[model samples]
Target: MPTIHSGPVCRLFVLLARDAPLGVVFRQGPRQLTQLFLWHTNTDTFEPGDRFVGNLSPERGDLSPDGKLLIYVAANYTMGHHNKGLPPRWTALSKPPYLTPLALWPNDEPYYLGGLFAARGSIEINLAPYALEDWREHKPSFPAGAPPEGLVFEYENLPWTPSNQLFTRLMRSGWSQVPTRQQSETVDIAFVKAHPTKPLSLVLGMGSGNSHTYTVHHEAGNAKTKLVGAVWADWDQRGRLVYSLDGKLFTAELDFPGKLQPSEIADFTTTARRRPPTPESASQW
Candidate 1:
């Protein structure tokens, strides 16, 4: 077990192995802009990596299964009030019409990436066929003479194979409202992490307003299992579940055949309480 440090970590993932490499989205200095870092547990230090000047936090990115590829949403920095020392202004990272994939390798260079939008926090890549889900808008449905009743948006889970064929849709969401009502009963699923070996099982973080929960659901089946009530949830390659709630980290053993039992592995609640409000925290509306 690694010692929990006292600082702002937007997101983190550790490979399941002896001396596993740790991937983290760490908040930098007083500005609190997030950047990716590779942590070496043996030396207890972080390796220098790429930096995103904008409001790019850990919640907007994820690491590939092998921890070699990084996919993230690139948000532009917005200038704060002149009275207060702030950052520069820029536009959103995602463009209109379609979602693009922004990828980075070990050399800290950009590569031609493809998928859906990088803004979604819940994105996962699987082995064998190699597929990922992209959330974007689809065609609008109109009732014959009706003027476009509502626009349909879907998280099209696309798969790529060896054949020279177009990407196939693996999973699709039901038609949701245009603007998405705040009080809507629809539970938005995000922060998706697929099982290391099981292609059919997926662990997802579901959020509805202030309440959140983590659940395990089958991709081709309907058996949904609630794992824990948490704001964020992730699984390591070894089938162990790690999650954070109220700023504390907990680990659960899920190799068994039944219900999950999580234990408090590390506590950063005190560190979180002592920190000042970040720009991301203040911008919540």
Candidate 2:
């Protein structure tokens, strides 16, 4: 038996129960499984909760802070076919869904690097903004101007702050001058409690320069998680340090700084308010 703690998720297939104090969901394969687990710090053991099942693949999922609406994503498409038969039949070839209406976690897009959704918000007729080439011919059409007013960006870019923000790096080859301030796009900002008692910390991802970098911004006094050619998909908090990681579907604490060093990893699958830490063994002085 192991004791669970209240913290961030470090693995995939995690769901915090809304009714139960500590109901955690973990995936066994395609099917998601939930269990009631308890944390008995005295002996470092976990108790079990009732089981529930669901699906939460990264590409098709919707688990908000309160766990109410389950947003789902699927291809919205019409098929093309070649009908040539004595009886006049048709064959199905392709159905590609346009990806848009990607809801940034907690907010709609057009904001600085926000959480992305798989669903398209809207579709307008006669809006083939980008040039399309015949698949069989493999010939491309010349690029064009802005898309229709309602046309969404074909590809959505998540918030990512490049290193160049603080200082410019001089690259000898394949480099160009930084864009002037007027050319810079104002990015959307989302603030989460990075550390206890710290000023607002922002999920600094979207930048006018590059959309591939993700970094954390805190007041001058807090620890910073800088992007080093990686995307932080998930985050959890522990003693003094924020545990940022990937493939999280459950909660755990990262006992150290950065995502590099993790402390005694414990699962707090249940949603119970903070309880004083119960020592597994007698305190040592």
Candidate 3:
């Protein structure tokens, strides 16, 4: 039998595009290493992107509506390997599935800084008051006072604290806070995010020192309810149920509420570390 090391459990976070049949997945395993994958919801296939020796913040990431650009917050504390002399923590913009940064901004404060797509080609980044640091391939307009045309920056110029920023991203994107009973401790909080069109909604709980965990609860019209062992889940662009469980991703048709016949999409627990080369066409970002 093959040896199974009792190492840390691998975790996955899925980011689906708003208007496209595309998704980006972050597979974190073993330790600080994280691998990125591009998911094609059109055919339920995944393509390997690249890996980073640092840690990526899923709460601080946002995929563009067209699935072309990716804005993520990454941190590398290693001193010798490839710190690049940039800040210890930074927010970066890169092509999906690849860690090769196209435009970078330095951040003094690492946690809770996030970015989102204002439109198809425009983005708003929160860098903790730091300015633009580098632009590798193509340079976008940088303005300190006001954003460029066709761009609506609501959270870029504002300061982001720990809880406010995280909650704002959820509310701003699609999620709404689910009401809970008033308690004295006030530790448990929940949110329900529904698909824009479908009748599916995912209930997620946070707080009580377990906000990073992605345990989900499924309640179908107040009839059938159960704790579906999903690490992270959401609806894909095609209105199909896409969820991650046991270090693997699954996609299933909404044949019936509260019952899912999941089809495996990708497994991250046994995924090998790879550094796929970025194609030349990826540089145009």
Candidate 4:
């Protein structure tokens, strides 16, 4: 484990982008710094490489399996403990904490979340998706203070129902005076995708449309397989998949017409992986 108390080190979480070969990493910090690393899966070795995100406080991040697009969630400051009269949850919103996300290519010029705030030593969270060149932001169906936490998605075990309803099981406190409550919420996002096998059948709704379900039919013979529910990491290429019930990462191979061949692979026993760090990168701070 890396030292957390040493001067002010942060935790860097790495995830693959929606469409790239290289991985993206986000590190937590009081100030931003650039640290890039390459992981040799075979040898379990980490090597230093180029500086990815310039010294930015990588608060949270999620990787798409295909390793293309890296979604990073960064904030100006963490929500600290204050306001004894109010519940802990109220601190999450006590101040309008600005969160700025930087979407970048590993070996290229990063699209910095620029503006006056960025110039003033403060990070900016532009909720405006239109400003993002290559990304499109979808409106969330659930209400504020709903079951899901975090800036975008900060919860686990989010399930989609048969009726196309999205459900989230979250443990929340400060919402009420009765300590944190284990809660759930459901909502519907109108979205659809063609079944991998049954071209005519539509797989409607998954992960606020970030995920979906489909069917696959073997062309050589007569066998129909239904993809119960699958989350997309990197389109049809090398992507990460999970069983809806067990939530395990399975290696996926997609055939031309949406047919999928998955192996019960356990690359890691955890849902998230801590990316290796680059030793030679400069500090963005």
- All candidates: TM-score: 0.39, 0.28, 0.78, 0.31
- Cα distance off (Å), candidate 4, residue 208: 8.2
Instruction: Point to the candidate with the largest TM-score.
Output: 3
Q: Give per-residue CA lDDT, model 3, range 190-282, as digits (tens).
A: 767776665567666665765433322344454333335566776677766677766777776544445555677776788555655788655
Poorly placed runs, candidate 4 (over 4 Å):
1-19, 22-71, 74-125, 128-204, 207-224, 229-234, 238-247, 252-261, 270-285
TM-score of 4: 0.31
lDDT against the true structure, per candidate, is 0.35, 0.27, 0.66, 0.29
Better of 2 and 3 by TM-score: 3
- Residue runs of model 3 more than 4 Å from their true location after superposition: 1-9, 129-157, 182-187, 195-198, 212-221, 253-257, 273-275
Cα RMSD (angstroms) for every candidate in the order listed: 15.8, 17.8, 5.6, 16.7
Please provide, for model 1 over 1-285, each residue's C-alpha lDDT reduced to its tens digit, 9 standing for 90 to 100.
234445534333232222144434243333444333454433434444444445443332334333433434343434443234321321111211111222211111112112222223343221122111121221212212222233122224423231111111112111112222322245554334466676434444334553555666555445555644355555543455666554445666543343456687554333222222232311111
For candidate 2, the lDDT comes to 0.27
Question: Which candidate leads the pack in lDDT?
Answer: 3
At residue 12, give the lDDT of candidate 1: 34
